[model samples]
Target: MARRALLTDRERELIEGGGDTDDELRYQAVSRVRRKIQEELTEDIDILRENHPDLYAELREVVCESN
Candidate 1:
């Protein structure tokens, strides 16, 4: 079965300016995506970091340490 996306295509478009072609479009998309992720996840992340440090660290290490 196909997995569902956490964010919808409309959400992506709203965040990404609808696939605009410009020199700065990639940069804009990256900035917008990063900012949106931080905005949406920061609160829950903070709570998890404080209350469930192990799980938080595991997730953080997986996402951050992979690269």
Candidate 2:
């Protein structure tokens, strides 16, 4: 799998371990990791939109239709 960018130490540890502890803390950590990933993906898509308008428009249409 491709390695993701900008992961914090806590995120790395959480992803690697299966140890069960506080359920609330685990949920929060998972939410934070998901948010970080979404932000990174949004940035990448913005770059693509700027660089390739036609492709971006096509992708936008497909995404919108799915939603």
TM-score of each: 0.48, 0.45
Q: Residue 14 in candidate 1 has what lDDT?
A: 54
Residue 27 C-alpha lDDT in model 2: 76
Query: Judged by lDDT, which candidate is best?
Result: 2
Q: How many residue pairs clash in each candidate?
A: 0, 0
Q: Poorest 10 consecutive residues of model 1 by lDDT? A: 2-11
Question: Considering summed lDDT, which 10 consecutive residues are worst modelled in model 2?
Answer: 1-10
Expressed as tens digits, the lDDT of each residue in 1-64 for candidate 2 is 5675556666767766667646666677788878865887688779879999887887678878
Off by over 4 Å in 1: 1-32
Best by TM-score: 1
lDDT values, one for every candidate: 0.68, 0.74
Candidate 2 regions with alpha-carbon error over 4 angstroms: 1-6, 52-67
